[model samples]
Target: KTRPVLDLRPLPKVMADPEQFPKVVTNLLLNANEAIQKKGSLIRVSTSEEGGWAVLSVADDGCGISSAFLERDLFRPFRTTKKQGMGIGLFHSKKIVEAHRGRIEVESEEGKGTVFRVMLPVGDGVREDG
Candidate 1:
């Protein structure tokens, strides 16, 4: 059995709530792990800069999500492919990202793989005015 491995890319410093960031990471990791049914699958985590945002991405070489689900079902509460899942993982992850004025996106092709991207603004604190 091969365990999932993470390949984390470098990232810049961004002002964010520390408490919520781990939740986002954990949710993505869980999703990646669930995609693979066998051992030796890989999960990659990377970060980079995109325009005014700090981009973080998690990729998995496992059973990928369907296009329909990627577009519609991923963020919905209580929607999961797994029989044992509560389905609140991605929902809560999305909420945490948005609360920090960020955006989360996913790319997946059935039988190929999946990639999840989270983008956050770079700043010292949340802007009160906006």
Candidate 2:
């Protein structure tokens, strides 16, 4: 499978903590790469401004997550599917997004794909850069 091809849209400038935003996106990209079953697997990233929100999404066309894992295990402290360590990336991402008055949304289908969208409030006066 090919890593997801990106289809990024122009995103508006958002009022955000520089450090936390980068960490959030990096965590998502890492997770997308980890989900890949092969080099051909597809992973895509996109950004947009919508209805007072700055939306960033990372999607993978790899093995989709189980509903149980999505519902119960995800975002909980100390829960993990990896062999090496506790699953803190998602938890931390969630916290950071919420700290910025944002929310994380997830969608997945077994054997199909998964998508994680981080939606942050865009200040009323923030303008587009390009």
Q: RMSD of candidate 2 to the true fold?
A: 4.4
TM-scores for the candidates: 0.86, 0.86
State the weakest 10-residue window (summed lDDT) of model 2.
121-130
Residue lDDT tens for model 1, 14-80: 7778888899999898888888663228788787877767898988888888888877788999999
lDDT per residue, candidate 2, 58-117, as tens digits?
998867788999999889988876666679999999999887878899998777878999
Q: Point out where model 1 deviates above 4 Å.
A: 1-10, 38-40, 125-130
10 residues in a row with least lDDT, candidate 1: 1-10
Q: Measured by TM-score, how close is model 2 to the native structure?
A: 0.86
Clashing pairs in 1: 2-39, 2-40
- After superposition, the stretches of candidate 2 with alpha carbons farther than 4 Å from their true spots are 38-40, 124-130
What local lDDT does model 2 show for residue 1?
Answer: 42
Alpha carbon lDDT at 126, candidate 2: 39
lDDT of each: 0.82, 0.81
Winner by lDDT: 1
